[model samples]
Target chain A: MRFDVVGLGVSTVDLIFTVDELPGREVVQRAGESVIAGGGPVATALVTLARLGAATSMLDSIGSDFFGSFIQREFTAEGVDTGGLVVAQGRTTSKASILVRKSDGARAITFSPGDAPELTPDEVRVDIIRASKILHLNGRHWDACLHAARLAKEAGVLVSFDGGAHRYTNQHLSILPQVDICIAAHDYAAAFAGTEDVAQAAKALLEAGPCVVVVTQGAAGSRVFSKDGLDFQQQAHRVDRVVDTTGAGDAYHGAFLYGLARGFSLEASASFASAVAALNTRALGGRAALPSLAETEMFLQHPL
Target chain B: MRFDVVGLGVSTVDLIFTVDELPGREVVQRAGESVIAGGGPVATALVTLARLGAATSMLDSIGSDFFGSFIQREFTAEGVDTGGLVVAQGRTTSKASILVRKSDGARAITFSPGDAPELTPDEVRVDIIRASKILHLNGRHWDACLHAARLAKEAGVLVSFDGGAHRYTNQHLSILPQVDICIAAHDYAAAFAGTEDVAQAAKALLEAGPCVVVVTQGAAGSRVFSKDGLDFQQQAHRVDRVVDTTGAGDAYHGAFLYGLARGFSLEASASFASAVAALNTRALGGRAALPSLAETEMFLQHPL
Candidate 1:
C-alpha cells in the first residue's frame, strides 16, 4: 500500500478562546488566552496518525479563503498529504468559534458552515483510496463517502467508520455493511441500535457487518467486541490533567488504526489507542499535543 | 492638505456570529449568520470617510498574520491609504469573537489582544499627520497618539478626539488641549465631566479646550455645543431597521469630520453625522452597510 491510511471528511479552522464564563446576555469580556488551529474529526485523526509515524492522505473540497488556507497548511506541516484536496474558488471555508470556561473546561461552540459546496461522488480520489491500507470516514460528504467506501472494499482495502456523538442517523445504517472496522461514541451506538445497553449495541453493530466493534464512553472506558468472540473492556488511561477533550475520540480512532497496521494484538491496540486519546487532552487545541510513537511508547511504559 | 483625514488607532478583525441566544454552558449551536470584517474606532471612521469620497489614511502597528492581512486589504478596498500602517513580523493580529443574539442585536464579545508590540512615538508618520486637514485618534498606542496630535497641531491641522464609551482615562486630559473637535459618547462625556447632565458635560468639554463639543446618545439624538455659544439637539435619523450598532459612533465621527472638511456649519455637520451613523446600523457589521456620499444624501432627502 502506498499509504497507511486515507481519510475523507470536512476540514475546518477552529478559533478557541478561554473566558471566565459563558455570556448569557450582552457584554464584552477579555479572553484569558486564545489559540487558532485546524480542526475536524477525520482530519484531526489523520494528523494523529501522521504524528505517530504513519503515512496518511486526506481528500476533501475546501474554499480558497483564509480558513481553507489555514487547514491546508496545517495538514502539510503535519506531514499529511493533500494530493487529493480540492480548492473551490471564491468560497468561504468552514470555521468554528469555541469559548472555553476558565474554572472548568466546558465549551460553547458556534460554527459557521461555509459556502463551499460538498464534494460530489465523482470528486472522490479513487486512486488514493485504492492505494491505502485503510480508508477511514465519518459519513461526511455523504454520497462521496459511500462511493469511496465501496471503492475501497472492491480494492480489498480495510474500511473504517467513525460515528461521532449526536451524528447518528438512519442514512448511516446503509453504509455500515461496507465498513470493516466500526468505532462509535456511546451516544451513536445507542442511537443506532435503538437501545441504551452497550452490550446490545455492540452485538447489533457486529451483526450489521463490521468484523470488529467498539463503543467508547469517555473517562469511563470502552468495550471492544469482535465476530471471533474476543471481547474485553479497556480502561481509560489516566492523565495528570485534561485541558480540553475536543478531539480525544478522533485520536483514539487514528491510533487504533495505526496499531492494526502495525499488526499489534487487539488488546494491545485498544490500550495504545486509549493512551493516545488521553495524552491529546493535555493541550488546548486538538492537534497541539499529539504524541509521537516514541512518546507514546515511553508513556505506556511509565503508565503516568 | 494631501489627505482629508489621518487616523491613529488600533485595527482589529471581528468575527461576529449570530446565535439564537448566548450559551451559558457546554453546548454547540449553529450560527444563523456569520461575518468577518475589519473593525476599530478610528479605522472604521476613516473607512466611513473614504466611502463618502474623502481621501483618508490609517496609522498603526499590526501583526503579519491573517487578521492583519484582512485589515490591510479592507482599508485598500475602501480607498483608504495605508502607507502609515506598520507590519510587525511574526506576531498575531488582534481579533474579537462576538456572539450576537438573533432575537435582538445584543452581543457578547470576547477579544484576543495579539502580541504585536505597540507603535512607538517615533513610528508615528509625521508627514501623514502634518498633511491631513484633520488628525483623528482614540488613545490607542498612547505615546504615538500624543505625538501625532502634537504634530497635527503644530502643522495647523485640526485635531479630533473620539471619546468612546468605557474608554476614558485621566491620561486623556493631557491630549485634550490640542483637540479642536471633541465628540464623545454620553457615557464618556459623563465620565469625563464627573456628571451625567448633557449640557453640563458638553460645557465642561468645551472648557477643556475644544472649540466644538458634541455628546451622542444612541437613538435619542445628539447634543452639540460650541465655544462660540451655539447649541442644538440633532435628532437621530430613523432607519428601516437597525441590524447592528457595532460601529454607529465611529460612523458619526467620520461623517462629522467629513462635514467640517466640506465647510458645513456646526448644526448641519451634526445632522449629517447623525444620519450617517443611523444608516450604518442597517447591516450586521461595523463597516458592512456604510453609505457613500450619494447614498447618504439620498437617505437624508428621503427622511426614512
Candidate 2:
C-alpha cells in the first residue's frame, strides 16, 4: 500500500515512573504512578502522523520477544502500518525506563536494546520508498538510512532527518547530502555547526547541505531557515502545567512532516508543531495527550 | 489439590525502569532499560514459592483486561495455581511502574489498579485455605484476608502476613491477631509499631499479638523476635552488583516461609531468605534470578 510518510528507525516501550521527589540514597519513597507506552523518535513520529490523519508506515527491527510484540501491537493499534517491521529472533527489542519528577515535567531515562538488529540497505523495500511522499530517518541504522534517503531523494520524495545528538561519529555525517530537511535538537545543531548560538547553529547545519534547517529549543520554541533564505521564529504555545516533556520533540517533528506534506508554509508548520508539542507536555508520555487537528486549531484560537 | 502455601492478594505486571540519575526540572535523559515481570507482593511471593518447588495457589481478583490475562499467563506458565483467581468484568488488573537509579539500588514506584475489584469474604474458599499449610496474606483485601486467615487458623494452619506499608489501615491491622508470623519492612514496622529502631520496632510489633515478628532492614540484615524472648539476627549476603532491587524483599519473604514449612530453625530460615534476596539483587525482577535451593546453598558457601 502507498503511504503519506514512512518512518524508519528504532521503536521501544517506555516504562515511566512519576515521583514526588528525588529519592535519597538507601531510602525508599513511593511514586505517584507508572505508565507504559510506545516510544522512540521514529515510532512516536509515525504514531503522531497517523493520529493526524496521515497514512504512515514504519520500517524497523524489533525483537521477537514480548516487548517487540508490544511495539508491534501499539503500532497497529495506533493505525500505523507495521508491514515493514522486522521481528528478529535473537533480541528482546528496545525498552526505556523513564522517571518523571512531579514538580516539573523533567525526566531521567534509561534504555537497553537487547539484541536489536541493525537494519541493512538490502532490507529497504524500494517499492515502499517509491510510494511514500516523505521519508523520515532517525540515523539509527546509518547504512540503511543512507540508502533509503538516497533512494527517496532519487524518487523525488522529501527526506527529513531527526539528528538526535551531534556526537555521532563522522561516518553518520556522510549521509547528510541526501537529506532535504534537517531538524535537530540545540545540542546537535551546536555540535554540527560548531556554534552554541541557536541562529548560528542553524546556519552551520544548513551549510552541511540541507535545503532547510530547524533547531528546536525546549520550551523556547523553534527557529527555521528555508532554502529561499526565509528565516522565521515560532514561539511555543504556553502550557499551564508541564507534566512531562518526554516526547515533545518527536511530536514537533511528526507534526512538521505532516504540515509539510499538506502544503503548509514552513512558518505555519513550525507554529502548529510547537503548539502540538506544548500540548503534549501537559501530560505524561510523548504521545498520550497529542491533540487532534480540531483540538490543535481550537488550542491556537484559545491557548493556555 | 492440597497446597503448601496459599497466597491471597493481587497480582500485577511490573514495568521497571533503570535511570542513571534522578530526574530534575525541565530536563530529559534516556533510561538504561525496561524490565517487565509479574508483580504484587503475594503474587510475586507465590511465583517465588512455585519456582522453589513449593505447591502454591493464588486467590485474588484480576480484571478482564489484557494485562490481567498477561498476569494469569505468567502465573500458569510458572506452575502456580490460578483456579481461585477471579476475573472481574470492566476492570484492568493492577500495574506497577518502578524506577531504579544506577548509582544506588534506590527505586521510586508507582502503580495503577484499574477497576480491580476487592475480593469479598464470601469469595474465600474455605477448603483451599484449610488444605494449605501456610496462609500468606498480602493485606490487599482486608476482609477477605481476615476471613481466610481465621479459617486457616481454625484449621491449624500457620498464617503469615506481609505488611507492605501503612496503606493496609487499622482494619487490616485487626487481622494481625490471627497471624502466626508477621513479616514487614523497617518502615512498615515503624508505622505499625510506632518505633524506628529495628529491635524496638520488632519488640513493639510482637506486642501487637503476632506470635513472631520479622523486621527487614535493607542491606543491613533482618531481625526476628518471638514472644517467648527468642530472637535472632541474620545478615544479608553481600551482593557484588545490584541490578534491580524490585523483588528482593518478596523473595526473602517467600524463602522464609518456605524454610519455615520445611522445618528449618528461625536463624536458618532467615539466613536462607537473606541468601535468596541477595541472589535476586544480582538480576532483574523478583522472580527472574531466583536461585534454587542448591544455588542458594552454594552462594551462601561462597559468601559473595
Candidate 3:
C-alpha cells in the first residue's frame, strides 16, 4: 500500500511501572502495576497516524533482542509497515523503565539506548520517501534524519521534525535547513534561540529555514509561528482525569502531520493536533491511547 | 579458594519496581523507585554464605546474555566463586520483574526463565562438590540436583534443599530423599505432605529421608523437625520497617546452613536463621540486608 507518512527514529520497549509516589532514597517500594510497550518519539508518532486511518511506514533499526522483536511486532500488529526496519545484530534494543505516578499522572522516564547501529545516508530509500506524503523524523539520528529530510525535500514531500528539548548537538542543528515544519518542546526551542521566551525562539527557528515552527508547553498549551501568516496560541485540552502524560507531544506531531497530509489549514491542523495530544494521555505509554480521527473530531467538537 | 558450600541453582536478574498500589486492569502508574539486583533461591543463599565468611562456589549454567553477565558479576563481587560457572551459548538468562508495593511492603514477582538450558548429570562437577562441606540445591533442576545430591551423599557432604510453594511438577518429588536438610515455605511443605498444618507437613517430610525438616511461615516464624532429637517452634523476628521481602527465605537457608556448618545446635541455628531472615527484609531485595554471623548473634542478643 502507498504510504501516507514515513517515520524515522529509534523505538524502545518501556517497562511502565505504576507507583503511588516516588520513594525515598534507599527505600524499597512495591509497584502497583507494570505494562510493557513500545515507545519512542517518531515511532509513537507513526503509531498515532496508523491508528488514525493513515497508511504509515517506519524506517528505523531496533537491536536484535526480545525488545527489538517486541517493538517490531507492535508496529506490525498496529498495521504500520515495518518492511523498512533493520534488525541490527549483536546489540540489545534500547528500552526504558518508566515510572508513572498514579496520583497525578506524572512520569519519570529512564531510557537506555542500545548499541543499534545508526542509519547511514546511503541506506535511505528514496523510492519509499517519494511515495509518502510526509517524511516525519525525530531528530535523533542526525546524519540519517538529514539524509531523509533532503530526500523528502527533493521528492516534494513535507518534512516534519520532532525535537523535544534534545536538539542541542551540532548534528541536530545541521538538519534545520531541511525541516519544513519543526515542532519542539518549549525548553528546546528556548535553548536554541538563546532566550527563555517562546515567541522569540519561534522566530529564530523560522529564520533558520523551517516554514513553520511550534513550541509546545504542557498543560499551558502551544505556540505556532508560520512564514505564511499563520500564527496562533492555543490552550491544552482539559481532561477530567489525566492517566499519563507520556508521549502526548509525539501524538501532537503525528496528528499535526496527518492534518497537513489531509490538506487542512495550518491553524486547523494545530487545533486538531492539540486535541489529539490531550486524548493521548487518557491511557498509558505513547501510542496505546492515541485517538482515532473520528475520536479526534468529536473531542474537538466537545472537549470536556 | 576452597568452598564450604557449593550451590547449584538458577539465578535471576530482577527489575524491582516500587509502586503505591496495584493499578486496575489497565491503569498506568509511575514507580517511586526501581532497583536491579541478582536474585534466586540458591544464588542468594550462596551470597549469604559468602558474606558470612564461608568460602562458597556456584555450579550452574546461565545463558549468554546481559542478565547472565549481571548475575555472574554480582556473585563474583560478593566473593562467591564463578569459576565453575558455564556460559550457555545462544540463550537468555532468567529474569524477574518484581513490583513492590510500599504501603504493606508486598511484592508481586513475574519471572521469565530464559532459554538457559538445565544442567545435566554430566555437567555436575564432582571436584567442586567434593571441595565443599555442604551441597546446596534449589530443587528445580531435577536431573542435576539429584545428581549433585547423590554425589554429596556418597561424599558424606550434607545436602540442603530450598522449596517454595512452586514445586508443581511431580519431577520435584524425586529430589526429596537426597535432601538431608529440607527447608521450604509453609505452602510448599503443606502441599508436599498432603496437609495444611505446618507440624503435619514437617512430620511428613521427615519420612522422606531428610534428617531435619523446616516449614517457614512468613511473619509467623518457622517450625523445625529433626531426627537428631532437635525439634522446636520459633516466632518470627520483628523489624521496625519491612522494606522488601524478596529473598528473605533464601537468607534463612543460607544462614541455617552456616549454623550447621559451624556445628551450632539445631535450635541455635534456627534462631540465628530467623534473625538473618528478618534482617534481610530491612532493605531491598534478598541479599542486600543479609547480616554477618557476628551481626546475627548481636541481633539475637539485642535486636533493634
Best by DockQ: 1
Better of 1 and 2 by TM-score: 1
Query: What order do candidates take by DockQ, descending?
Result: 1, 2, 3
Chain A of candidate 2: what's the TM-score?
0.96
Per-residue lDDT of model 3, residues A181-274, tens digit only: 9998988887788898888889988988899998999889998899776779988888776777888998999988988889998888889989
Compute the lDDT for candidate 1. 0.93
Each model's Cα RMSD: 2.0, 4.0, 11.0
Candidate 2 per-residue lDDT over residues B1-304, each given as its tens digit:
9998999988888776677655444345555766778888888888878878889999998898767878888989988998888899878777766667777756756666667789889988888888899999978877898889889988999999998855546676688888889999888888876768788888877777788889888788889999999888888888788777778889889999999988898888899999988888877676778887788889878885
Name the docking class for model 1: medium
**DockQ, every prediction:** 0.75, 0.36, 0.06
Tell me the lDDT of candidate 2. 0.82
Each candidate structure's count of clashing pairs: 0, 9, 18
Model 1, C-alpha of B98: deviation from truth (Å): 1.2
Model 2 misplaced stretches (Cα beyond 4 Å): A165-169, A196-207, A238-242, A265-268, A297-304, B12-34, B62-70, B87-117, B122-127, B154-157, B163-173, B184-246, B259-278, B294-304
The whole-model lDDT of each prediction reads 0.93, 0.82, 0.82
Candidate 2 residue pairs in clash (backbone atoms < 3 Å) = A109-B30, A109-B31, A110-B30, A110-B31, A110-B32, A110-B33, A111-B31, A111-B32, A111-B33
lDDT of 3 at A221: 92
Best-fitting candidate, scored by TM-score: 1
Greater lDDT among 1 and 2 belongs to 1
Considering lDDT, where higher is better, how would the candidates rank from best to worst?
A: 1, 2, 3
lDDT of 1 by residue, A68-169 (tens): 888888899999999999889999889999999988998999999898999889999899998899999999999999999999999999999998999999
